[model samples]
Target: MDQKTNEEMLMFVEKATAGDKEALETVLLSAQDLVFNLSLRMLGTFADAEDAAQDILLKIMTHLSSFQKQSAFSTWVFRIAVNHLKNYKKHMFAQRPLSFEFYGTDIENGKSGEVPDLTQDVEKSLLAEELKLSCTNVMLQCLDAESRCVFVLGTMFKLDSRIAGEILDMTPEAYRQRLSRVRKKMADFLKIYCGEYGGGKCRCEDRVNYAIQSHRLNPKQLDYTEAGEIPLQTMLEVKKAMEETDDFAQNFAFCKPYEAPERTKRFVREFLDSPQLSVIRNAEGRG
Candidate 1:
């Protein structure tokens, strides 16, 4: 199902809110992949994404009683995730923010010296793929948080404008307008700097050595390249829009679904067995 049907969602909320631990676990786990993937794209690294995702999930569970069943549970979860990520201040990219201009300049002038031989453990092509994924993921950091959210929801996630607008508290028209502006801004940047997607000379293979030397990407510990994939259909329930422009789909196609780390489930299990949660449950009359 693209989205949870209303009856199924209400059943989950009722069971979860009434202290059904198994149902609650099911609800939280259902949201984990969507929240983590969004966090990954917004925060620009696996570790930061996982950290932010854990926080967001906690917020969702604690606030479960406040859900009024007015929207799809997935939509409610997404709303919370987006709000948390936009306001999160401790992520690496937030600490050292990037702009398109600065990133483009780095792309043009960043490479130095000889390309290293990274064919020790894995093929050069694998390292190149790692660098390419790293580079594109980092590029989203160039957009401000709000614009990045707009691009991610509108383009990468292919969310319906109406639902996306509701999540961001914007009118559909306004969301679409912002999405259009950011799309052009990003497309222009890619056209000028990305060789694979545009006319620029900067190739992922050409920058692999510099990326590794700068510690931007680690060949020994490739977080994204080593992660498991969740097929597009198994990801968030995005309602495809007919108006979504086709110009940059290929450019951002690297925004595929990556599975959340297995520790998230363990974290949830720990919370369920904690005294802190016991206090919360008793206070909320959920036990």
Candidate 2:
């Protein structure tokens, strides 16, 4: 059977709920980066990020029954993230980790360790480790729970504000206001760090603009739907799908350049053995 958008995701969750360990792993594998990035930004410690990610996933597995599809699956997943952060914050306040490293050094007040030397022409932080820690922590400190949920959902993950609002139980207007506040705070941080988009300091805005300029967002630039690096069969399936959908080409263009490196060829060869994505690819062709 062809899995509609969100159908497969929900079925995957259902399998996990039924104690299908492999299905649970597949869900995590699909969303590992999303979980890790959110936790990393929210908690401000890689260790804490890992803990939070796992805890949230496990918690979701336990509470999968509560997900009645009231919102987009992504939003539902993120609501779990929001609740996890609240628990994490409570833990942080109860027992503060007095000494921590920023970019790899002990900062007196949890500031980002100085930005590493910039890319010769960029003159910006380039989202280096230190800069992420610094900016993320600054943002975290400023946001209350609702604001943080909105910020993480709307900005970082690029969820629609309406979806984010739904996840956080806020009115659309309220969500927009929170998003505005988050953007203002982000702008303030960037102004301080990069001096109005890297004039005197370094900024992520420059990096973002550069990415956009490079046409990185152009669908022709990536092949996300193609799922390259799979087996010959999956490759054929992906290729067929690529030929079928103009939208797939555009949407996946940014991912095409990411063909697996030779170093990981051996591992990928094994992973491509899965038939999981092949059905979707075939359906795309028929569509």
Candidate 3:
């Protein structure tokens, strides 16, 4: 989704805050992708991401009146999302074993059984991408929730330290420090496991068959990420797009961008069509 200008965002915020149901729907709808992506990356499961996205959207609507506008509307929305995910992670106890451990266990226990020979180059390439996304998604769970959030916001979403700090309610210095720590930890892991960072043995191509045998990669149903969409670049500036260079850690974190599932869009539309619409409109009439 394209970034909105301050003027454009303020207009939406004004209308939404005044309880205009259409404006409220537009504002939330524009942010659906952002919320869903963040939730999927943070939660590491489609079911959890969908649930979190729905809950976060509801929170955004319920708390729309409390948005003080001290920061950009996007930043405020992100603040809610980041905090919500952090809490949700705690509630869900999402800190599972790293992908490497899980894959190793599965392979050792003969859980994957026999590998199927995929002769088609097109099929191989697609599976390779899917494996990369699956591996990266699980690897992200290795970090603590705070570190994961910091790494994602700084590397994948490419938010600057100040804006990212505001989203997490931290000082820029603190955010940078946390991001540095997370970067170092992730870089170390990538250097050891990712072939792109080094000659790591755990190449995505090598894992495709294992992932398939283990039912992690279903050719018919590609989950976790979308096909043909470009990953979000390391864009720091709000208005200007920057060239993305190969930083070992950043590259690993950004291998796959989260794609909002169709279900999420449908949920938002249904929400806008619900009785909540009456509540927002009635609030507007009262105001």
Candidate 4:
């Protein structure tokens, strides 16, 4: 049944490729689900995903003429999907850190399954949840724009090193090497501040909550400090981008409210619920 569906879907793709509007729309409907999934995983928020999804569809329609069938139809669409998402991440990270999740002090040590000793515990389960949320926000904040982009794209999208590297315009080996550094830096940072989980010594079977990255660490290579580092000279550009983002958010209602909707907000919150997204925040009243 699934195979037959693919055959039918391909026929629609053929027509869409020939510039049939109805066929294009049908093919897009089939493809948009993947686009939405990519957006959700890559962007880590429902609001962001919806916005990215909408933009992708529009780009498909607008650039439909440019899509040469040198690759598979899905591949063409995915290329657009990848580009749109990378742009969105670059925009958001430049603006401000999006909120994440909060687990607890034992986050990175791979002890998530130990089941909280509620009855015999000091803090309630609610505190754990709050900490998880705070932790996620802080992690996002710590990630420089490129690091956040690479980690989310490689991790959530689950793209192979080669493909992920292709999306970022780098060779496969370079991509893996750089990715290793990004992951290592992020994991090391999270452990120190968020209270460590995922032992560097844990084997494949035991390292569950956080997989101890057996891969080599290359922090210096993946470090963006040399590129966009917010130094004394670069402060002006950083401030300008922040100010623009603030202005955009302030007037976001008039621009586009994709990420602000209730449904999307809930989706983002759910995505952030993962222990890894956890971060510490200085929010005063509402968490």
Instruction: For candidate 3, write residues 1-287 as lDDT tens digits.
Output: 33566567668878987767778777777777778778877877666788899899888887787888787777888889999998785433364445546544543454233667642344777778777776677677777778889878877777877788878889988888888777777777666657745445566676676776665677666674453343453111255322232355435644455556778878888988888778865775676
Error of 1 at 252 (Å): 1.3
Question: Candidate 4 lDDT, tens digit per residue, 1-287?
Answer: 11124446567766865646567556655555556655654554444666777667667655665656564455466678777766675444436544323222233444535533332232333333323332343354455545655655454333565555655677767766666676666565444444223333323223222221321112222111122211221111111111110111211111111112334334334433444222311121123
- Listed in order, each prediction's TM-score against the native is 0.93, 0.54, 0.82, 0.48
Scored against the true structure, residue 16 in model 3 reaches a CA lDDT of: 82
Query: Candidate 1 residues 223-278, lDDT tens each?
Result: 87888987655655545652675366766777778778888767888888889887
Report the poorest 10 consecutive residues by lDDT, candidate 1.
Answer: 233-242
Worst ten in a row by lDDT for model 3: 234-243
Report the C-alpha lDDT of model 2 over 11-98, residue by residue, as the tens digit: 8878865656567656555444455556655665444665676667555545665678765455576778777786675344225432
Q: Which residue segments of model 3 deviate by more than 4 Å?
A: 89-122, 224-237, 240-250, 253-259, 279-287
Candidate 4 ranges with C-alpha deviation above 4 Å: 1-10, 19-22, 41-44, 89-93, 97-141, 195-287
Q: Using TM-score, give the best candidate's number.
A: 1
Off by over 4 Å in 2: 1-4, 90-139, 193-287
Task: Go through the candidates in order and give the C-alpha RMSD of each one to the true structure.
Answer: 2.1, 13.5, 4.1, 18.9
Candidates sorted on TM-score, descending: 1, 3, 2, 4
- If both were scored by TM-score, which would come out higher, candidate 1 or candidate 3? 1
